[model samples]
Target: MDEQTATEAMDNFTAIWNTYTLEGEVVHWLACSLYAACRKGSTPTVGKGLMEGNCVSLTRILRSSKLSLIQFFSKMRKWADMSNLSQDFRLRMDRLERNFEVSTVIFRKFEPIFMDMFQNPQGAEPPRQPRSRKHRRLPCHISDVFKFCWTLFVYTKGLPPLYRADGHVSSDEPPPCVLERLCELHDGLVVEAKGIKQHYFKPYIQKLFQKQILKGHEELLTEMLDPQNFIDNNKAINREYEEYVLTVGDFDERVFLGADADEEIGTPRKIIQEMTTSQTAAQSQLQQHVEKSGSLAPSTPLTGRVYLKEKDLLVTPVSSATQSVGRLQSMVAGLRTAPSDHLMQIFKSCSRDPTESILARVKTLGQTFKEHYTNDSDDTPGAHIEILYYKILENVIVQETKRLHGRDMSVLLEQDIFHCSLMACCLEVVLFSY
Candidate 1:
């Protein structure tokens, strides 16, 4: 408004215009125009800032020149680097600079638009995080299905007959009774994973390939092998998967080993016959006693009969007792006929929910404590304690950033197997003391 200041501003603009070429002037004019919009409180529409010789058309003219692109970015960075701008503005500017250097096309297309937004933000507010890439592998579908079956077998302390083919199951179905029982005791050792094929190991990986973020399949299989990614992920997914394999996976193995006590080449027919006889005898005894009398004899003289009948008859009738015996026998028979295989344990651990009941709660708690330091909350005492109960996975990315880092891009890639392995280890350490 003052004569001298107006003259000085005009002189400065003229000097800048004369010194730079038509292309360079574009960046300068665009920067100035954007800065003015902020100062004058103008709404930022993409069309508002474009002028006859502004940065927009300047970029179009030099579409074929890499030098022009570089120079334009340089000017953009200089403008963003201005000290008078707010810290949040500075970050957007910095990101713009990085975008240009790393993602040239994206930088060119969006930088100006973003710059306008910063100039006239919808309201005076703090900036939010920009979208970034996620690099953890997820459990595959088959792996998830297997883990669920293993969990069912372990929970029941044996493979149900419906899940078995013959008197003996193979290594792929339910393990031997000893193994199944063991799995129940250490079902905490059984871990699970899901979304591996889609979350981490998706069917298509063209984006990762284009970004040069992945390598060989073997390397992808072991992406969580690094320690740094482990720590960061420790607070996130790495801890979860590590807990699964360690707690859930281990339990499955224990059950398999325990269920199959006799590792001899073959089970003799005599032994099978003896086992069957014993089972039948137990069933017969329980049934006979339960069915002895539909209801206590009207004049039965047992000392406690009168009192027992009065208290128990309401909920459990004599006929119910006989039925219960039969149900128990059926359960036993089903257990006896269940499979004895362990091959699908890996797959099973990848799918099912790890924190379903009381046992799963304990399993998860143990896993969480293993990775991160226990939560410190007196009021919400067992808040994080839930984390310790069931086996929850924590995924992490451990990159080899130093000597052998770059040679293996696989470390940078994602994979479910590696994620679960790390999570299993963490859970095991946390749950089982040392």
Candidate 2:
């Protein structure tokens, strides 16, 4: 063949290979292409014998058998002979021959039928015709449904930080709103296509959860939920605060005093006395000027320096109850609503006793608070709200435990039931956030 014909033949072969590769039968289809090219005498310079040798080499590389190639070639020869007498083939060939690019046109025309034959190489019986039935069942299996759910869960859980901004699986899990809609779709499909109950596959799903596909992820889940982790995180913040204070406190004190202690060549007492004398002398000078001016002129309030006495800077200690109440009030301010007002009232009433009735009331109010605030927006409540809700619940549980066990057994409040309730509440909040 000339250069143009050879290039066109290669392009046609490539297209055929690509289409067959999608169906996972590239080697067989390639052998058929070689057979067709040779039979049509398309590659004139590259004779049939050399083409057969190339096919043998390719089949070996592709791990196909010579016998299969030979059989495929025989089938192609038979098809070509029949094409001469077949009116449909004759008509298509005549129409394609009208094109100047006859080689590509012929290849494209026959490639589909050749692919069909290759797909059913054994010449199996044709598929059964569709029956006219009122209902048709979906081909989905129980395993397939479970696999999809598990795959979705794993994909979301394992997403890199770029994809998961919040980065906690519980918080990052697919939203319940979205999942509910998906389940609705699933139910519709089940009923319409399979003629089954909406929840016919519920048992399988339950079993999957019971099996815990995330079985080995206990450590990660615990790390995410552990209260001690939060406590340690707070402690880290406090440590950083202390370090900052120590580093900057002396410098601030020196700047406020208007003289660096190291620059003054004197004992500590002498330096203090000198600073005091200068301040008194300056005040006296100002008084004399004011008296001379005959009227008290407004002053600029000493520009920048902040004067501090040792007594004025003392830290006052606050009781834990006052602190807790103040924190709770601040948290409640985030939700400016009637439900929040009701919650604050309930919190105040439960402060003294926190009885079972009071605890139940708080629980009911919490659910109401979430419903009222979360129903209208995609955004969850701020972290402060979630933390405060759990903290109050923890305190109430502790108080009830202490009331039942007596003051001597107050330490027992942190054990058993208290821990479990706190964990459960944390998990619920995490899931609710998602």
Over the stretch 202-262, how does candidate 1's per-residue lDDT look in tens digits?
A: 2223223333333224323334224333233223332333333232211122122122312
Residue 38, model 2, lDDT: 31
Tell me, by TM-score, which candidate is best: 1
Best by lDDT: 2
Runs in model 2 lying further than 4 Å from the true structure: 1-279, 289-363, 373-383, 392-434
Write candidate 2's Cα lDDT for 145-164 as tens digits: 22233233322322233432
TM-score of each: 0.17, 0.16
Query: In each prediction, how many residue pairs overlap at the backbone (N, C-alpha, C within less than 3 A)?
Result: 71, 1
Worst 10 residues of 2 by lDDT: 248-257
